[model samples]
Target: MTDRRRFADAVFRGARSRRSLRTPHAPLVPRRPPAPPAAPSAPEPETGLETGEPVVFDAFTADLGAGLPTGMALLVVIPVEQGGTPGFRLRAVCCCASLVEFGDVYGRPDLALGSLVAADGLLPVDVLSSMRTWSRTKKGLIRWLDARRAAHGDDLQLVIWDQTGYGIPWELFWLERAPGSGRSEGWLGGLVTVTRWLSIETAWGEVVRDYRSEHTCAGPVAAYVAAEMEHDVSLFGAYHLENSDSLHTLAKALEEGDPLAMVYVACHGTYGARLSDCVLGGVPLDRFDPRRFDRLGPAATFVFLNACHSGSLVDDAGRFRDRALRGFAEVFLRSGAAGVLATSGRVGDRQAHEMADQLFRHLRDHPGRSVAQAVRDLRAEMARMTPDDLLDVDGPEGNRRLLPLLYRFMYVFYGSPRTAVSLATGKGV
Candidate 1:
């Protein structure tokens, strides 16, 4: 009864009812990432920013449960990384160079996609985050997932992202005996976002990102990618409010009793303890809820607040509690998940993407490896490019704005594949 089974009957019906449609090829991986000739400019933080609210990282920790990995509570790195040099990597099209560097390198999870074209003939399956979109030959693929769900007696976990306008070709998963070809294949599509755009001043040759779009790049590219994966996965989403219809669609899906395994919200965060870059849902923030999972099918997992503050705890003063760790990961695990990985500080988008790339590479290339080992590898690579501030620990003391600005936006998830940490706040990472 994996999440996939919960919707199996309905999904097949949706497909069989409309099998005639044009095949949408996954976007060719971008070979050359676009770049601007000049650096970027920053917008002033909105006037409503409550800087007057004293931030207490220690207090935040008390509110959250223990069992969090060290550095699970702080994410002061946004300013650190943005203040430095920026680099660009292509979107979907994986150049020959990337193909050569596949499993062990750094890349964005949702955008810089990599996949294994199953020799048995199935559409490429997104390696990282494990989502599926489009299908040239649907039969065998459907059988495979169906069998997995029934055999596991668990809901299939569907990880979704940026589905604002993406649509999946449901017919692609149906199996059929094609002429002469005994076996059928399916095409899988996934992309990793390198450096997102705040507002593309293509006019100025600049690619930037801001708090508004949740690191969403500007272009039909994102829209196209979103539409591509609309129909598959257990529960898929890279962030909340990704597009106009995202919330609406999510509400509808939940209402219809779809089992959502985990809801990953990897977006703008602050050391002050807010999942959103700006206030939302009444508390100057938004939090994850397990009770909302009415139709989780048969899976024990619920929500994942992969975004920064997702694991951060709040002290009595309402500030972040743990200066060195965020408790959201602990909460996610304590509440229950296969596991949760979170960041204590602002993880750079590029770094996050790269980490995701390595994580997925390890998962696919080295099947059955422990998630801890995967993260270990990712951390090792990230350590290679540590910012100068982190490297110069003796230079200053106590959360230097310049220091966090140097290298804190790193992505970390803290949760057992089946465990969640306790946060009195129950913010849900």
Candidate 2:
């Protein structure tokens, strides 16, 4: 066996032994009452679109395996009190098996992870390297996941259900190099299909909806691009908004127009504590109410915020807030978006546009691939591309190499992992 295999074996053995000796902890009790049953699943009446069978969004239960789809595993990270001190409890559950690790205390490193990701103009590779090293040390949590990933292979979909407000970027966790595999090391997001979820109350209060059943890639698309990005208008075809500054108009349409399949925005995003302060395409995010999305019906409206800090959530002190603030991504999800693809840090304009192009092309080419899987594949694809492959080598200095490497890790997806887009033609609509 290789050294990596040996290490994994040791870790697995240790985990099993630890579990055997300790009593399994009780399930976490929900602070609020269980959410109401979701609207009954029904077929699309007008469009004759093949709306997949409806699946009710069940209330959050202590049983992680309850309602979990086959071939998908959930890694739930909850902040809990351990021995009168604050710590995190991690549970990895799938159809075949379940693993639980507790007493993983939070530290400065945990808090700093978010800061490093949200920082301006840092090399993404360096931040990813730091995350990888940190993952190695968390033998109880990350190592367990590594062992599970190795055992389960690449087909498993890892859904990170993180309740910890530490701003832990779970997707960036680096798994050790596979045994005997010549491929270089990769982060968790690149290696497997990953999606994220928060509590129902936190995401959309009293709004119980399953994005998988409601959302598909084959539908009308709405886009909000900046004036400078006019050249990229061909990306969305006829769906691109003519006036880039009309984000408010787009928001109104999303609220009142026909159920759109996807909402794509390519512009500048500023992160701030208040909703009014956080701006997307020069329009404060506060203008796009979650209720407006709630009115769009059950069609899975996936939003792609292709801008810097569009996916970030921070506080006045610039640290990851423990509370779930209604940020850009959250508002959409809460308002009933099937899923969201956003960036966690500052991204180069050219790189962001390229990432957007590659993403849409991938979804269009692969009709039935889930958004989560597409993101995973994209991350892997980007990781394999060299600086020369992605950029003009002689064009610029500074971040020529770093931007390509960094941008891949910046994307953070929020929503159902099973949500997919099906474009019969080149247009997103």
Candidate 3:
């Protein structure tokens, strides 16, 4: 109409001068977010577990979370391994200077192991000193024991403690005195350097080194519970000692076993709830059959009780005495026994040969540490240390120095899971 109103006001002034020259003058600062890279301190393996012992065994692989081995059980005093060696190599079995001279592991009876102390003595020397009882002849314990003398047979017949050239040794015990000066060692450092344990031994070197690295309760939880309790062992029967042998051949080897044959008992441990019916006359017990040739109720599966007070319980005083010792590990995991490794009192002899040579060298190099990942890596390395006095099963000093050695002594169980994974990490299962 006048050139269309001057071309629509020159297109609105050329689009507002091209948006005011793209609107920028002197004020615009907003762009942050990029600061999170500072967690690389790196120093937590102090020979704890990457397969420990300064690593170098070869063949048994299992890089870390390890796996393989569906069966297990191993107790040691020393038997470092030889004969095609694929894995398993740890041996300390007390020599770091043995201590506990309470003496006489029974056989003399009527409670005299120093007359249950208290003559003004709170010292078992702060306990947990050398712990590794028995295992010297091919690492003794039993079950096919030697297997026609290894050298190559895929060896199976349990119990080994044949130490080669002995390197880790010390102590003989008689130190009837000595308990001062920053605690030097004796009476387990006079009961772990008391002052009420110097602020928990000065924070146990930063919570066993760096507040227990991440979790799975890490650190060789003793080598992932010694390779899941020594992977894949298959014993049939013959484990009676002087009741004149013959639990009917263990029930004819639990009735020609192998519907998954897993059970090992070195013998004697006690405490109760149910499965204590005279102790290890054992197995789906209510009576006895041992399988007279075979029957295995929940399929019979795994069980191992290297004896010595099978995880000690019972302290008497009525009203289900702490529910009969916490229902003795839930009636052996509800009697079908898929896992059990007892021993809270009377365990030393070199801590059962350093816990059966680091549990068959961590299951010959972590063959996936089976049978419930070897007691949950020994109950998470016994619930992260802090014992030096272990076995209080419920206290009163575990019922005055462990209730009659775990109520009538009897041992062995492996399998019947539901609770495990503690080697030293206290606070109660």
Measured by lDDT, the strongest candidate is 2
Best by TM-score: 2
What would the per-residue lDDT of candidate 1 be over residues 155-228, giving only the tens digit for each residue? 12211111110112211122233356333222111111111111111342322111111111111101101232
Instruction: By TM-score, rank the candidates, best first.
Output: 2, 1, 3
Tens digits of lDDT, candidate 3, 219-318: 1110111222232121111211111133334444544434323334443333232333224323222233112223222233333444333433232223
Better of 1 and 3 by TM-score: 1
TM-score winner between 1 and 2, please give it.
2
lDDT of each: 0.26, 0.58, 0.25
Candidate 2 per-residue C-alpha lDDT over 1-429 given as tens digits, one digit per residue, 9 for 90 to 100 = 755344334322321110011111112221112221332111111111123334232343345565656667777665544334444546566756764534345532443332453222223345555676778877666555666666567777777766544567777777776567543456788888888765443433445345334357445667777776665677766453333356776777676655667778877666555556567776765565344564334666778888766775433223323233446776777667778898775565666777778887887688778888888898887667744233222222322444466567678888778888753334454
TM-score of 1: 0.32
What is the TM-score of each predicted model, taking all chains together? 0.32, 0.73, 0.23
Off by over 4 Å in 3: 1-125, 130-253, 256-258, 261-301, 306-368, 379-429
Error of 3 at 260 (Å): 3.5
Error of 1 at 250 (Å): 3.8
